[model samples]
Target: MKWLNKNRVLKVIFFALVVKPLVFIILGLNVRGKNNLPTKGPAIIAANHNSHLDTLVLMSLYPLSLLYKIRPVAAADYFLSNKYRAWFALNIIGIIPIERQRRVRKTELFSGCHTALDNDEILIIFPEGSRGQPEQISRIKKGLYHIVHDRKKTAIIPVLMHGLGKALPKGEALLVPFNCDVVIAPEMAEFQTADDFVKQLESCYQELKTYCITTTEQHN
Candidate 1:
């Protein structure tokens, strides 16, 4: 529906009615460091990618007031394969699609993301690039590096998510209900060099993983 695209209210209603319930009620989520989640925009949410549910889970963490402001950075090839999928992703989910296979200018590639940042919109980015194995964190990609290279003012918050892969891994459509773990880290340090910043992100991921282990060990 064109109305879906024209009206932000409808988009907010969809997430409030559908995404929230499906993520919080059907799947169930255990989130820590929620206090670290950004209340406003111009922030980058860097997280590991697993199931498609990862986007929904992350978006649901934000308040309904910020629903329209939250845009997930997704792959153009996968999400925009056809008209129906394109409409849903672009109109409903409000994703900033990046061309993965085709060669495009740096400015053209990250144009949507840049605009989002300029508008103080929160961006949900999976630093791993694409979905990896269920419950396994992949190496942080350089794409995120390019987006934030010059904009040191914007906060980059590292997030560690668990169990979504098992619930709905890559190539599977049916969702198996699972209790998910989400740890939202504090804003990462400002970048010095590309290598240093990426390494810091990877290190942050490891620390969060270790935090999960330490917390589980304490309960045992």
Candidate 2:
């Protein structure tokens, strides 16, 4: 897990010079309800997946101090396919890869996530499983629900991002400059079941979409 170790130098160089200016300055990121995030605690950030930029955009919103504690859960088959890709994913990005295709033991999947939370780190998970059409949220997966179920102390933060798919859509290498909005809702709790939690998660996405549309209309 040497690659997974928090490298302050790498994180500083990447986010300060690259991600921050690219996302917040050049691309023009609009964030709403950011105050809802706890200043410090173990959290599970559940958001819709669209573009590869989705993870970067989400992480950029966090304070620099907390950046080192953030870990994005990625697909093992895609991110760890080759040596170069694996190096970049584990070393540079500090992602926790999970086997999505082959049969993975439940213990294996939960172990990685549990360790992160146990260390008081933030875990970014896309419950949709994979990227879908831009701005279209897909069905929630059971992985997130299971993690939350086990780690009851960890807070669940529902996030909604718009325009990222268009900026760097699926299958496209180049990133087109586009304005994006990210809405961070209050931490959710009190769900009786995982299915109930999924419903609430979907609702958070829809509410954020509506807010984005309204804000856009007002600006126009």
Please report the candidate that would top lDDT against the real structure: 1
| Candidate 1 Cα errors over 4 Å, as ranges | 1-6, 213-220
lDDT of 1 at 159: 97
**Model 2: pairs clashing at backbone N, Cα or C within 3 Å:** none
Indicate the residue-level lDDT of 180 in model 1: 86
TM-score of each: 0.91, 0.90
Candidate 1, 128: how far from true, in Å? 0.7
Off by over 4 Å in 2: 1-6, 213-220
List model 1 lDDT by residue over 174-211, tens digit each: 89887888999999987778789889988988888865
TM-score result, candidate 2: 0.90
- For all the candidates, what are their Cα RMSDs to the real structure? 3.7, 3.7
Overall lDDT per candidate, in order of appearance: 0.86, 0.82
